[model samples]
Target chain A: MNLYYRGYLLGDVRRFPHWSEPSDAAGAEDAALADETIVYLRDDFSVVRSPVGADQGVLWDAMTPQWREFCDTVLRFRPPRESADGPA
Target chain B: MDRPDLGEQERGQAVGLPYIVQGGGENLADRLAEDRAAIRDRLRTDGAVLLRGFDVGGTDGFAEAVRALSGELLPYEERSSPRETIKGRVYSSTEYPPHEEIFFHNENSYQQSWPMTLYFHCVQPPAAHGATPLVDTRRVLAAIDPAVVQEFSRRRWMVVRNFHPDFGLPWQQVFGVADRAEVLKLCGDRDIDAEWRSPDQLRTTSIRDAVHVHPDTGEPVWFNHIAVFHMSTLSADLRDGLRELFPEPDLPANSYYGDGGVIPDDVLAHVRDCYRSAATRFDYRRDDVLVIDNMLTAHGREPFSPPRRVAVAMAEPTDAGARP
Candidate 1:
């Protein structure tokens, strides 16, 4: 299943592919992106969305180019399926 | 290396670590100054060294024992929980309501700096049931599911805290400064992201490694407060009450993955289970001292009846990334 990250910016949804977890340059974005609310999504249609970090909008730019593009595209934003466990 | 007369060891079968009782007439307080290195060696090797019959007299004596073990006690700075500083670097341990159980955690693991060692002295045992349970973090790492451990390592963790006077300790009390500018400076120095969530409220988030190798022992350990700080850990009633009482952004404290995603509840449940299965506990008698290597061990409190008093002191501050 493909992994994607969904971030909330000013009530708008920014969807992108989930990249490798931050260690150095690739993970932590710049300070300016601290306002975005990040959440992890999966193609398996799981209803639960795991929270990444809040107020870390600065790190959005640190994502890879491909993931950044995915975040910019809103049409591809697929919501998780409804399940018994409900959204997390 | 001088040693105290020891009594029968207990709990050797249940967990790998055993509790050593001191023979009568021997006081660790008098002996620790001369034998600090030996005791420190034992702490590093065993993860926890429980001393009963040490005759650590009172708060003053406990502070002395701490000083003997690790020179120059560090002030409890950048605090999250409420605790009273009794005397020069000695403080009451997380002075929470006696009915609540304080979950196991490495001291200051959420901060950019933490003490390498911790000392807890039992000034007075609880009236009914009070024991400081201990768990080896290495065992916590091993007990968790491999996938869960892998996920934690990859994603890391970030603790988001909203400090306000309405609930919990305010930022002014936590940072030991009343001025907003000073608090901002302290946050800046510690690499914490601080913001004025509102006119009177402050929000801070700090990222930390979920798993880290012990600085002295070079052994991997689960060393973050994700389980303890997560909102899911609270009871359903308490969580609901809190959500109703405060706005979402102003909730007292909670945690998330380093990348700003939610940590699954099931994962945290598994983690709590591992901690429970591995925890070791011994009755705390008066005049007892427990010294633990903070990175190698995690500690928590059990719900007790009343009249329980334990003093804590920390030393040997190790800055983040300083561990080789």
Candidate 2:
């Protein structure tokens, strides 16, 4: 299976900030050039984008060390996810 | 310190200390009225009242008794709004020296609504000074000019809640109504405006120019644009500018009216003089519970020696607009 690690950029994401499926490679390229490009890592972990998106979870899992470091460095105050027991 | 005088003790609680009722089989209404006639009358006529001897005895006993009584009268949620201290939910007067010449006004007057009744139980009354002076707003209204009353009734007034940094994040976020939409919704057809601003190191949201009438009596009240606009603590410039605009109708310093604005200076001076002239002094004895109508009367304490303790509980209307 050919996997394309694609994501959104900071600027483009601002217009449509809510979570959504990734656009095609051409659109991603346009967003990249527009400076709205976020970081995107391929299946092999080579390509890097300028901005990041929520859809990069799969790419993040593949590069555990880099992903952990990036999260610790950038997103300092992310709240813990709710447990299966549900909200209090 | 004088030994507990048995003679004074047997005469009921000594002067200036809280006393407890073991269990008096009296109808609540009758008891409230009979024991607190001065306060009730003040409430009916003035919109506020105070009883001095409601709480007396040892500090712990007074606090516990008040807490229990308050729990019965008010719900848990309502009780949460009270100021807490090491002694109890209600801060004792002993912690802070009472302000002398404390002017007449409602408690938390800046809010959209305020407590309908306020009760102060005297744990210890000052040996000298510390007499709670009372005033009735109805008398004030009756005393003022009919033309002035008519004009105020017709006009909408403004209220601005200046945000204070001391409120911290949680308080700042949830200080007033839940949100702007809530305020608009609650205001309904009333002609009003609101602005959120940062002033004096506090983020504040001010509601401008709203009209309100007394819910029960349907009396045309001057609700709006007094404490928040003209009070010295809020904005001196706004108050001064307002005075300049309505020079003849300037609000008096250190005083407020039920109409939700500053009582006019001339009227204020007259009322102040009347209060001063009619002032009466009394001391507190233990086991007395004094209740007053929050809206009908204004209350103030005379200065006193330290270690004076008092517990307070405020009663409010179940209906949102009935009292504030």
Tens-digit lDDT string for candidate 2 (B1-324): 111121322322112111122224333333343444443333443343222223244445444443433322332121112243434444543233343233444444445455555666666555444545443333334433566555545543334333334432232233334554554444343322333333323223333222234554454332333432334532355457646743322232222343456556654343343333212223444443444454444455555555565566555543326422
Reported per model, the fraction of native interface contacts reproduced equals: 0.00, 0.00
- Local distance difference test scores for all models: 0.67, 0.37
| Native-referenced DockQ of model 2 | 0.00
Residue-wise C-alpha lDDT for candidate 1, range B84-153, written one tens digit per residue: 8888889998888776677788999999989998988888887765677777777677667889878867
Candidate 2 stretches with Cα past 4 Å from truth are A1-88, B1-89, B93-100, B164-200, B203-281, B318-324
Docking class of 2: incorrect
TM-score of 2: 0.45
> Candidate 1: fnat, from 0 to 1?
0.00
